[model samples]
Target: MSGQGTEPEAMKIVLVGHMGAGKTTAVKALGGVDVDELIESREQRTVAEIFAADGEGAFRDLEERVTLELLADPSVQAVALGGGALASRRTRAALTAARVVWLDVDADEAWRRVARSPTRPLARDERRFRALHAERQEQYAQAADAIVPASHVRRLAAPIAALEGMPAGAKLIWAVTASADYPAYIGAGLITDRRFWPATIAGRRVLVSDRNAASHYGALFEPVLTAVRIAPGEQSKTLTQAEVIWREMARTGVTRTDVTVALGGGVVGDLAGFCAATYQRGMPVVQVPTTLVAQVDSAYGGKTGVDIPEGKNYVGSFHQPAAVIADTTTLGTLPPAELAAGYAEVVKTGLIAGGWLWRRIAAGAAPDDPDVIAGCALTKLRIVAQDELDTGVRQLLNVGHTVAHAVETVTGYARYRHGEAVALGLLAELRLAGADALRQQVLELLEQAGLPVTLAADVDVEQVLLATTRDKKRVGEGPVPFALCIEPGRALTGQPVAPAELRAAIMELVG
Candidate 1:
């Protein structure tokens, strides 16, 4: 609230996450105060000892009181909050007036770090500790003004230092993967904010944009040595277009240090990123995603490619970007159909995330909210960090994309938008999962969002079914590996659905 409109004011930037997230260490690394240390120094006892003597309820009361005191103090710039501090509603509400950064840590990593430590009182039980980590992630993500991986924090100080200077209401999501890591800046006016641009783009830039995005937003980026403008739409996202972009980069004397600015929707992001991935054996890319679908899903993952006749994204590479700047203001100019299409990914993400984000979508949160976009981005970031190549847990992020890609393939990529096909595909996958109630709920939500819950008139059900067998995720001679949502917040990959059931699900989409 302090930096939203009027002149800047003092507001505490608090770091929070599960136990073993290294909050105290991160605070020290950033030169910020640690409230837990302050509390321990006053009590003359460790936090574990205090918890043992006073119990969690009593400890929380003191934590809430002192945390508020620290946040209210004008001199305190930032503080590392206790892991359970956000469990208090009043303290969570107090964060509204503060800048909160969620220092992210996976449950396994947290457990591994704190398991044998005598100082972690509540971390004695592995089962309960993991459950609590899952439970608290929803809170941290919901309250965070920015989300940063715990692995990146000591180094994160540089980016966090730029947090307050971002456009009002802006949010940051530090995306980490096995290949590379980058910062995702989501806000109202990030495109023109030169100060918010990553240092990776400080040198010359070779932009890859579509006709629409170039005419609309291309001129805003300064000192771009050259640009390769291609036709808009998925139809143009092909190796042919990628070759066009490669030629232009070669002609412009582009080199490894120059950045590729992907300035458009998923089409441009995928094609340009593919070109950059191969050009000079991997140059850095800065994804300036201007569409809802791209901002929420494609821009951050580094899975860049073009569609071929065989299947969607059949030829691709794992080329992570140097940065992703999603200026939400661009969403305001999108057509109604594009926004509705984008909402499908939001629903798919919420279903996969299944806790705070699902509740928000069920309650009808708008797709354009920076928090919603950042939530979807963070969910994928967490998945990619663990399984960048989609060889394992990363498949969960494809809960609805398997059939969606098939739909796009059989329909020749023209009958439905990527998100629209995904909306229908979600219903199909839920039907396959036999989650009748959840499927109905998602159906109603998609219908409300103006998405097509049924197959298009020209789509061939049998062809769509055959296309699924050709799915890029398939290996050997088996059926396409399916990722299913058993319930909110839980998903499993590599499931086999019988042919009869697959037909039923696809047929259901027809009606």
Candidate 2:
């Protein structure tokens, strides 16, 4: 086929998702050039006919060729991909420069749409169809630059237009609630924005950050606040460090009206927030999370505390920030290991949310993508809004954290990253909950994300059990409230499990 010659790199919009995700329909509704016309202009048979005449492998090769050709055609503005087309790494790699949109559809609805179609080879068996859809959903997520849910497909024109018009480095805001509500901004170069500083931060601003974050971005905050750099590491998240910050705040004449900015990862955010919670009976604080984990999870909720020797987060309070500024560009400076660790929380959020977000992460979407990070942050914010006190639905956020906290405590927070322990914790908890299929899927996703899937050899199982007994989730002399996965996007929280069963699950992780 001849390529459209000598045209500027026109923005090619590609629609991707599971079978029956309405990609083609949406593309048609989008009222752009007919992608199928271009395909038929090159080949005689449709994708379905090709699959029926040959096989999946043959169809995949043709799909890749056609997709590449279409993407190269400057004349083609929008195209729809077959459900499994993105499973080919070559196809995905080729489409990287194109504007890819994922039509996020759940398996049930997708099956309902395509079940009666005779030409779909992969949709023949119900169980197999669901599994295949689940698997490919992740691939679509990874390949997509934007995600439009199936429900929104009919109205895809507006969002697609907006995406086309959106400039790079644009800021998106999500409202997060703790004791008070605040805005969380996700974008590049937000530190330079004058509006990032809330009006409440007028007096004696104190910026708390770790040495690593301070060295890189400290100058941005220097113009406004007196900076306090703490030593970086999980061990530094303690009452002693919090006291040091408290003393510094006092010495700096930080009054109750002034704001304290937690300008690092979870450690600094927690410790600084704890100080804000206790200092002068609670001063307003702002969270400027620099790490992926902090951006998505810890920075939103009002939960703040330093870890005690007895357990993690043993000393803390529900001190919400006045605002949370998640400058996604800061993630560029994060080590690969730290980035992978942050993905565990993303996975955990997916399991709790169980829809497009879960599918996106399972598909290996870049953890640091502003939209992905914003989705996770908003998920937490919605849940926190409902149960700010952690008394009800909010506990679902702890799906993998029960044993995760124990592992952190038993190993003295040195052996594994918080998200790594959480990954292992997810597996054990899934096994304990008898969600074997979901467990295997999550295991594969973690492996793909380069997260640790098993407990370290030196980690003492007995010590982990001991730590669990003292977990804050445990009510007076009863079993700890464990969040157990029933399936993707579905979990039963605060479930009571026998000590023996819990121990057995923990032992399974000992590799």
Q: Would you estimate the TM-scores of all the predictions?
A: 0.90, 0.66
- Candidate that would win on lDDT: 1
lDDT of 1 by residue, 1-511 (tens): 2245533235567899888988888888766788778988999998889889999788888888899888778787778889888888888777767778888888888999999678777789999898888788778876777788888767776556546455556777888777776778887778754435754346688888988888878888766899888888887889988888888888889998888999999999999899989999999889999889998899988999998876667799999988899998888878889989999999999999887788899889998987788888888888888888878999998888889988988877778888998998899999888899999999999999999998866788999999887887899998789999988888889999998999999998877
lDDT on C-alpha atoms for all candidate structures: 0.84, 0.76
Stretches > 4 Å off in candidate 1:
5-13, 48-58, 68-78, 87-99, 115-135, 157-164, 192-196
Worst 10 residues of 1 by lDDT: 1-10
lDDT of 2: 0.76
Model 2, which residues run further than 4 Å from truth? 1-178, 192-204
